[model samples]
Target chain A: MVRFENVGMRYGLGPEVLRDISFHLQPGSFHFLTGPTGAGKSSLLKLLALSHRPSRGLITLFNKEVSSLARDDLPAMRRKIGVVFQDFRLLDHLSALENVALPLKIAGAKNSQIYQHVAELLEWVGLGRQVDAKPPTLSGGEKQRVAIARAVINRPQLLIADEPTGSMDAEMGLRLMYLFQELNKIGTTVVVATHDLGLIKRFGNPVMFLKDGMLTTRKQDELPSQFSRDGG
Target chain B: MMQIIGKSAELQLEKDVSTRYLPVVIAAMIFLAALAIGGLFSLSNAISDWSATLTGNLTVEIAFDPTADLDKKVTDAVELLSKTPGVAAARAIEQEETLKLLEPFLGRNAALGDLPIPRLIEVIIDEDSAIDLAALNEKLGEAVAGARLDIHRPWLDKMVLLGRSVQILAAAIMLLIGAVTVIIVIFAVRTGLIMHAEVIQVLHLIGARDQYIAEQFQNYFARLSFLGALPGLIVAIIVMFIFNFLVGSLEASMLPPLSLGVEGIIALLLLPLMVALLTRFTVRRVVLGSLERMM
Candidate 1:
């Protein structure tokens, strides 16, 4: 559902952080994006999330060219792409339920429908009892789950998670991964960016490895057994 | 569940220390604006009253001449004015009444009948008839020496001009207050946008349209402006009433009461709503423009 070709990005007169990045994600496909620190994984996710414009080249999402899309069209396009940020980014004043309900509320869903759907999703993310708890009152893992719940509440066509399982325990992390897989099976294209090689190995998903602003792909079997978590 | 003017839900702008006193500033601005409006409408009504009272009315003044009979001169002027076309009635003002009119300037306890006071003949013209005032004045002057027609035009014109100038000044003050309010709101909204930049970015990435976020800021700011405007308008009204009371209590005050007619009353009542709408429109523009510069 997404295609990027020769996409280069920079931050205002700076050198390109991502250069000549080319990739295509088929509908319902799931891929793990692994890279070292400052390798531009977040920048790539930003582009996928339609948060920034690439310095050069083309990006097409759901058959529409990203660069050519009008500003007014971005919100509608963004509604179809769910992004779970690394830091959670949940509004501190809003309860977990309200945070998760934001997407539906923005999409103009009825309050009755929004709260019901949000409650169900939060419950699924193991945050049912903490629905009324604000982000400041929640733990790191709880906050991460709330963030994930918020991202997928709209049932977006494409789900991009940046270090989705970084703050959680292994069991909880695997459970959230299965949630992503279930969404993938239901036809949501999934892109998970992480530095956790161990989790990547267990997932056995196709890998898109980024290093020094470049991207290279490999199957799960192609990775060396001794690959380091630092992405060396 | 979106309120037009309510708390900023996601941003939680109500708790910000930066904008805590913004309503007070807005209240002060609105207070000045309301006073300006009151002056504008009060001056307009006073000018209208002056015009209506002076138009088509004339006064015949016979100057004091120690050797001439002032009573006879007044009688002749009244007779001449009565016979003139467009003249409805002519009656000479009594000396005692004329002296009483001057009592405020020339004290009531002053020595009686010592000064050579001129005689005045009040003349009323027909509403529909056109009277040649110059021709009548010449006839009266020829028939009765030192007799002159005081049409009240020169004095009325100067008073009207002064009133209009004050009205213009009041209007300018209103415009300045409006400009100041807009600028203050812009600064507050910009600060809000800056302080909540992180939440805004998060909202944007999560598919919230710029309008959605702008509404939150607009609504919260509008609520503040509306709440602030109420007290400002009320205090202004109370001040105006107190001023009118002071004017009324004066023995012979030239100052008119703060009588804002029908339109002014309506405008005063709508001040709060107008300020709220203005804040809403301004905040929306500032938020949208700032958000456009983001992603």
Candidate 2:
């Protein structure tokens, strides 16, 4: 769960990027964050991901006031939140399996558990045969799946994806969206930042729209749930 | 077929430009440092050997003698010193041997025809001898005119001072090299961090601890330090052995052969381990501090 009230953010003496902003995300709620380019979508995601502090106002994550938390305690809090980057930030030197297993390793999971879970997740993401492939050798969609598997491998309480479907084909994108839906069904709060309106309309989730750093929430006009595998 | 359990963080940095060059830098630094330390130890050992030989020697020289025959004056001095209670043995040095001792101040082939030279008598003192110096001088002057007792304190003090200065200078040089090594490692670590910044952001989002990120850098550098320092130490050992061999090959009596004692050799042998530890600590501190600032 994330709550921001009157939050204003800027990068070091610059004009505020997000001004007088406020929103609260309920536990297990799924929302699509929509904005045009440079609409501070990534910046908003950054703040939610605990990467940056709000320059003004109170920001809370999982009931703990983030701005008041000590810097050392941030990492433990972060392990509960998983992020899929727009660039598919899988380590270039690591294989698909290793990349997916990274969060589990960081969490100090046993070797057998990591191998079994990571292998099963990678297979589910359509990377079953490319487990040993490094990121450089993998296609864009393959790398995206690897990144997504890495994000959800730990089953973090909060799952965030930036442009999760950007580099993938329609079938794979819908499948991945269902994956997110399936995760949300199991009680993981999801906030996906994207400009993909077709996927947004098809999935028909509640939308959080941001323009000029101000945010508004809306429930999408319900569409046919053809791509919805989890029956939202 | 990789046998290792999982990829370590260091491998993440394996391709960076700065990381690629780190091993060579560490090797070169350790090489030079080992040679300096080895040279210092050799000098100390040589000085100790010299001190052991030079001390416990009492020399009796004829300051002035009424008799014109230098040989007769040397003979009387030797006889009186031989009878002295604390004297173990006294012998008159031959004129040629006396001239050989003067060969450094006087030219090697300089004519010795009219050169006024004092008669020299070497006195070997008993190990437990408790002879009173004033009494010995009085007895020597009475028995053999103008006989002077030389304790060689000035020469011994100079040797000790020279030994101490070389040790201090070598130590200072090592410290300076160590400081430079730390600086180089710091720069390397910073550059490595820059190279891995993108990956680090992802890792950070995944809740990787600062220590987890730092260990990747630390392990890489520590390995480089060890790998680099071993060859450097080996090269130093070989070069020093060759240098000592060359000195020994000269068969020169005046120049002592360079060699390290057991302790010095052990220290030199441990250079790889020491460098590894230094690299690990330096990298860990720099990386943690840098990450703390960045985060």
Candidate 3:
């Protein structure tokens, strides 16, 4: 469902932050992307989420080449791929329910249909009681849940999470990982970017390790048992 | 809560400090614009009135001479003018009436009868007939000594020219107001975009179309312009009415009252809506263009 061949990226004439990054994942396959700080993990995720263009090489998402896609077609492609930001980019003024309902509302779904589905999803994400709570009023974990709900609201064909468990407790992190697993089981391709080795080992998904603007794919068992929090 | 004009729901633009005073700026711009419109339309109507009243009308002035019988001269001039074809009617203006016309300039205290003043005759020409004013003037001068035909053409021409110049100036002021308003709105919208850039990126990544984001900015700014235009328009109308009242109170005022006919009234009423639409279109273009540079 996703492919990247020798993709190189830089920011506005800067040196390449990601270089010669080549990888591919079959439909419904899940992968963990791990790298040290400044190793371009977020940049790679950005390319996958259709947030930025690769400076060189090919990126195919859902069988269509990304570079060749028209700007007008980007939104529809974006709608099919869900992204959970590392910062949990939920609008602070919006209630949890409203934040979750954004994708549906933007897609022009009827009001009644939007609220009903958003309420159900918020409940599933354990935010039913906090549905009316704004992001500022919610705890970090609660905010993360709201962001996750927003991402999955549209039942996107691909789901990408950047440090999905970074702000949550260990148990909460495990639960959210299980949620990702459940989504993956239903034919949604999942790529989770994290520096947490323990989570990587526990999930035991295929690994795409990035370092110094380069990428390497390996089985989860091939990962070192210990590594610094910075991915050293 | 009441929905404000052009509220950006997703961006929460209603809370931005950057655009908080946009309505006030728009109000000031619209105020000047409305006054310009008032002057433009008022001058147009006044010019039409002057042309209508002066056309086909002539004035005959018989120069005063102490040795001449002014009454007999007036009687002969009236008879000759009446006998001429294309002359509707000719009546000698009474000496008392002529003195009354000079009352404002000469003052009521003057001994008007002792003063040497020209005797004037009013001439009405047939609407359908073409009279050679130059030929008629020569005939009147030959028949009665020192009699002259004054069609008021030169004076009316100068007045019309002055009126038209003022109209052009008013139109230029209107165009300047419109340009200033657009620039102000452009700056305000750009600031709003910058302030809300993070949220905009979030929206875009979440699959919100550029048009969806643009709609919020357009709607919010349009509302500001509309609300601002209303008070400006209201104040202009009030000022116009007060000016007309002051003009009407004068005994022999040369100033005409502000009288906007049907077209002017309709234009005044549509100012708010037109400004709102302009704001909408401008905001949309700026936002969509800015968004195009994004992913």
Candidate 4:
């Protein structure tokens, strides 16, 4: 679960990129965050991920006020959540399987256990043949799938994805969304930020729309046909 | 602790492309650095022992007054030297022994029966004796007038000063070498961090602790420095032994021969360990500092 109350963020002396944002998500909830270009979707996801502190306002995750958490304690909280970066952010020097197994490894999982889970996840993502390949050798879609596998490898309580399907084709994008849905059904809270409205419409979830640094919450049914087909 | 080991292993795997060569390099550096420091220490110690053996005993030379009774003057000087406080033993040097002392510089056949060499008395001081030169000089001067007593103070002082200077110079050189090692390790760690920025970012994003990340680099650098320093140390030791043998063969009375005894060898043995410890501290500090800045 996550709650942000009147949150505001800026990079150094720059103007506020996210202003007066407020939202709350119940445990096990699924939502789609839709926004135009430069609408601060990534910034919001960063806040939820505990990567950057909010410049102002209260931000809570798992019922604990994150703004009050110590820096040393932040990692423990972050370990319970998973993030899929738009850039995939796979270590180019590491193999695809190694990249996916990173979270488990950081969590101090046993090698045998990690290998087993990672192998199954890579196979599930259809990367079994390319498990030993580095990111430079893998295609964008394959990398994205690797990133997704890494995100879910730890079975995190909360999953945050920023443009999870942005670099993939229509089929791959749909299949990735199906993965998120499956995760949500298994009690993992999923919050996905994407510009693709077609995928959002195909699998409707509660929507949070952002424009010009402001967010407006709306039920999935409230989106107009055109906007629902292709996010604004 | 187990978790840290696991994480380190994972990181090593992740950085296999570069880290594969790092351990061998580190081991070799450690060995060389140890060997070099050991050799330097051994040389310094040998110089110290050689200087000590030469200057440890005081020498008293009695110049015979030709006008006086030579045997009587010799007997009186010996009696006075023996009674002086801190005089372990004083005896007149035999004619043959005196000639032997001069053989090295004057050559075996340079001196003949015609040359007049001053009769000298050799004084050996006890290890615990504290020779009072002013008192001994007054007593010996009065006992046999015009019979000068050479305590070898001027030359002894010079040797002591020279020995001390060598020690200080060696220490300064070691300090400079340590500073250079620190600088080199810092640069290496910084370059490694920069080259692996993406990997670091990914690791950080996945909730890896900064200490965990730093340990990986620390281990890598500790290994590399230790390896590189090993060969350098070995070569230094070899050079030191060779110098010791050459100096020993020369057998110069003014310059004592070098010796690597038990104490000297012990000090040399500690060199590699010291180098390894130094490398560990330097690399760890640099890696942690760089990681903190990167974060």
Q: Which structure among the candidates has the greatest DockQ?
A: 3
Error of 2 at B75 (Å): 8.9
Clashing pairs in 2: none
DockQ class, candidate 1: medium
lDDT score of residue A40 within candidate 3:
95
**Which candidate would rank higher by TM-score, 1 or 4?**
1
- Sorted on DockQ, highest at the top, how do the candidates line up? 3, 1, 2, 4
Candidate 1, residues B101-192, lDDT tens digits: the string is 98988798997588988899998889878788888888888999999999899999999999999999999999899999999999999999
Clashing pairs in 1: none
lDDT of 2 by residue, B1-295 (tens): 1211122462466667776777788788888999888878988998887676665677788864444666677888887888889788998878789888889888898997457777778888787768786788888888777778887778888988988898889889889878888898899888988877877878888888898888777887787777888888888788888887888888555667667899898889888888888888999999899888765
Predicted complex 2: CAPRI docking category: medium
Candidate 3 lDDT over A1-232, as tens digits, reads 8989999999999999999988889999999999788889999999999999999999999899998999999999999999999999998888899999999999899999999999998888888899999899998889998999999999999999999999999999999999899889998999999878899998788899988889998677777776666655
DockQ preference between candidates 2 and 3, better one: 3
lDDT of 2 by residue, A152-183 (tens): 88889999999988998988888889989999
Cα lDDT tens digits for candidate 4, A96-130: 99889888888889999999889999999899999
- Candidate 3 per-residue lDDT, tens place, B181-249, comes to 999999999999999999999899889999999999988888888988999889888989999999999
Cα deviation of A71 in candidate 3 (Å)? Answer: 1.9
Model 4 chain A TM-score equals 0.94
- How do the residues B1-295 of candidate 4 rate in per-residue lDDT, one tens digit apiece? 3332233444443354554454455444444444444445555675566556655555555554456676677788888878877777888888788888888778888854456667787777667667777777777777787567666667767766776676676666667667766676666677777777777766776888877777787655655555555565566567666766777777554544445567656655665556656766776787677766543
DockQ score of candidate 3? 0.78
Interface RMSD for candidates 1 onward, in order: 0.8, 1.4, 0.6, 2.1
In model 1, which runs have C-alpha deviations exceeding 4 angstroms?
A221-231, B63-73, B83-86, B99-117, B126-146
Candidate lDDT values, in order = 0.91, 0.83, 0.91, 0.75
Q: What DockQ would you assign to candidate 1?
A: 0.77
In candidate 4, stretches whose alpha carbon ends up further than 4 angstroms from where it belongs are A92-96, A123-139, A219-232, B1-43, B54-56, B80-88, B95-118, B129-138, B142-149, B241-273, B293-295
